[model samples]
Target chain A: MDNENRIIITVLGKDKVGIIAGVTAVLAEANANILDISQTVLQEFLTMILVVDLSECKIEFDELCERLNEAGKKIGVQINAQHESVFKYMHRI
Target chain B: MPITIHPDEILETIRMVELENLDIRTITMGISLRDCADSDGKKIADKVYDKITTKARRLVSVGEEIQRELGLPIINKRISVTPVSLIGGLKSEEDFYQVAKSLDKAAKEVGVDFLGGFSALVHKGITPEEENLMAVIPGALADTERVCSSVNVASTKAGINMDAVLTMGKAIKEAARLTQDQDSIACAKLVVFCNVPEDNPFMAGAFHGVGEPDTVINIGVSGPGVVLNAVKKHPDVDFGTLAEIVKKTAFKITRMGELVGRVASRKLNVPFGIVDLSLAPTPAAGDSVAEILEAFGLERCGTHGTTAALALLNDAVKKGGSMASSYVGGLSGAFIPVSEDAGMIRAVEEGALTIEKLEAMTCVCSVGLDMIAVPGDTPEETIAAIIADEMAIGMINNKTTAVRIIPAWGKKAGDHVYFGGLLGSAPVMDLNKYGSKKFVSRGGRIPAPIQALTN
Candidate 1:
């Protein structure tokens, strides 16, 4: 219970430079460790999905999501951060 | 890297919630008030208030907690109690009014939007006290803000009570008159049912039946928008493919309701009831059930193939929702409440949908003729006849059906009545000018159909 802090972040918009660097900088600042990452570009639009562990985040979960969203806005992408359980429960079974 | 989750699924759910207005409509707690009955009406009302307040005191807080923790919106927290008519101690309209007030006060104290079960089950026969209670429904509803009332006047097993239907029509008109300044909003809070479910968690028809447990939790799922989104993805697909998509979408939405119901039940220490898989619509764009029908390529909702399309949609929803949860009950189909659906309002305005068309649609869908508005000059007999027709559909088909029509006072066909927020606005639809006074006045019973002979 003390260590399980999985979260999923998805970034979607037009593909551009430094999209990875921009998102990870805010995550690193929030002390969130990226565990899994997948990125694909389809017809000039970028879709980046990341699974991160936020057990040791420097900020609250809600605040971390807001900060990541703000960082994504700076790069002209839409970022959505959600607790991993939302996906696990919905997708797994 | 092991891909533990599919990005598409996650993104789809997030998109549905953030953009398409997907939500859990209501989490209702059913509390049996059978124990609150007393020889004295005042004492019974007091007991009813005490029991409901104590049992449901934490309902709103618990609902808010679940919403915040899951990051899923639960639109309402509500309570339903045992049918007031069955609590036989009350012998007069004043007693019924006292009980209605108690229910209203309890709802406000618990911070819920609505409370149901100011009801009477008169499908078979209307007792003296039940008749008296029926006489008071209009006053009761007019006196309380959040109190919802329902009457069961017909069922497959017991046939249609035309007498009670006539009474209900009169009562509805009275309620409309009582709230005429508010555009007959009180009539909007009253529902007439045939084969009403004991575990329905939706209003204005929910009530804790005698068979239900002392206290239980039930959830109603909301996702007309999510299903519409899925349908929009395959606009050109054949009907078979479209049905598959709706089934899959309904499966996912019902699962969310099941999870929320279980979690809410555990948190409140109440046994979990059923998840109602009704595609309830709101006035918001992209959230209308009619839009879902239109997604199937109908020029508008009330075209010739509307019933066929709705039948498929309703069946697919039940099939998918049943698989998602062991318990699926209530009115588990798409709801066609015109005032509550933006697409429907537009359809009616454009002459694509009508009260007659809606009545035909009800034979294949869930609730019947819901949230409709008729001209103020419409007679009580006409309303009773409409209710009778809807009830007959439910009885013969052996399905649940209800009518919640508001005869908007001083408003005629094409005129609009706005109730605002969730209840939304209504464009007074035209009713047949021809009268059904004689037909409705023949008030014995439309004897139970042959479908009830299965035993």
Candidate 2:
């Protein structure tokens, strides 16, 4: 990783197969390294947490959100980036 | 880890708990602006600017950093300075607007979000300078974003000043008119009080009184969310058990309050004031003092046993918070403002609480007659009477009490005044139709009886 930044992306929606694999495949194409991943299936709900290395990625955060937005639509989920600054400010000041 | 409580059950109970529960409402830094007092106006203004900015430049930034470092949400970071009247003396009319403009400029320089020294502690009588400042308040507040103003018209020891009350009633009307677009919200930033404590952490009314040192720090710690969440957790817990829950919660929250307040005061090089443990509520969905009572299963507050229950909670909170923080003063009881609190508004709207009931609650609470809204035509005499009555309660009981009522212009009883945001929207509650002409007229220094002052 040539960069020092990572974004924690969370996706939550109706549980379906291949959601994780599909999202990871998209990240692989972008040359984004998935540093850590966590997924939980509760009842009919699926929640995913992904920390991706963005140092070498040739995309801005907004573009990443845009890419994830399409994946979210295909998987019937809502995808959003947690504003690390607000979280860091609120909890890690 | 050995499993004790089930995670699902924990989430269920936590879900029952309010999310915003246990919030630190405010951290107020009190800086003395008296050093800026001078006959030459510009010199005074420069001193005022230098004193406040030097004393408080990093207050908000430090508080925000502390909040983040501790994962504690400090909702409001405010500065309370020496009463501007004390600086210029309430003598010259020009001093009023000029002093206000100076304060506005100084507060902006320090990056202090709100500077609250545009004050007149005229409990006994309004000095000429104080009166001018009072008259300038509406325009000062309407014009300045970072300036907060307050006037103390009554105190337990001095009794209620009828003239000041009368003037304040008119001032309220004027302030409401000035910020009419904000639904008279400028008044929300103001407080009229009996036995107003010198070291209150809340805004508009917070000012370093003449008696205070060159600089001091006071904290107003609030935890309505904590108590509400604590109460909601136990659906079947009786009042005694409920009191236990609130006490435990109060202890934890107040500890954090005390820690933060002490650290902030020390860092700012100011002496710490009392930690106000008032469960101040917000218009925001989850923060309501009334909802905590509702969770106790009274259907609503102000019913039979309402006073007893609230008194119990008030006492328990005081006990818990007192143990946690060394200094505890101001209106430290659960705040029962009508419009600013979602639950209290609901209770008032449902006829579950009355002004009389609220008065009874204030007997044991930190403040009396707070954030309550009445009608515009509610007679100056009636306003005086209400002030007199609330003052009597505070004076007789020897407690710090305050009244912030917005008599919405052109709005009558049962009409709602929407101030929006943190001020919330006040539902027009009715005041008695009778007159206080005789009582208010007879007011002349109701004398500080032996029972009035304590330490």
In terms of lDDT, which candidate is strongest?
A: 1
* Candidate with maximal DockQ: 1
TM-score of each: 0.92, 0.78
Q: How would you encode candidate 1's per-residue C-alpha lDDT over B299-395 as one tens digit per residue?
A: 9999889999899999899888888887988889899999999999999999999888999999999999999999998999999999999999999
DockQ of 1: 0.37
lDDT of 2 by residue, B1-455 (tens): 12122334223222222265556678887788766767676577667777777878788888876664344568787778887888753356666787778788987887766788788888788776787888888888878777888777766667767788777766777877888776676777777777777777777668877787777667776667767777887999776787888887777667667777766776776788778887788887768878877778778867777777778888888877787777787667777777878888888888888898998888877677777778766776777677777877777777777777777767776778886667778787887777877777675666665763445
TM-score of chain A of each: 0.93, 0.84
CA-only RMSD, every prediction: 2.9, 6.6
Candidate of highest TM-score: 1
Candidate fnat values, all:
0.30, 0.00
- What are the candidates' individual DockQ scores? 0.37, 0.06
Docking class for candidate 2: incorrect
What's the lDDT for all of these models?
0.90, 0.72
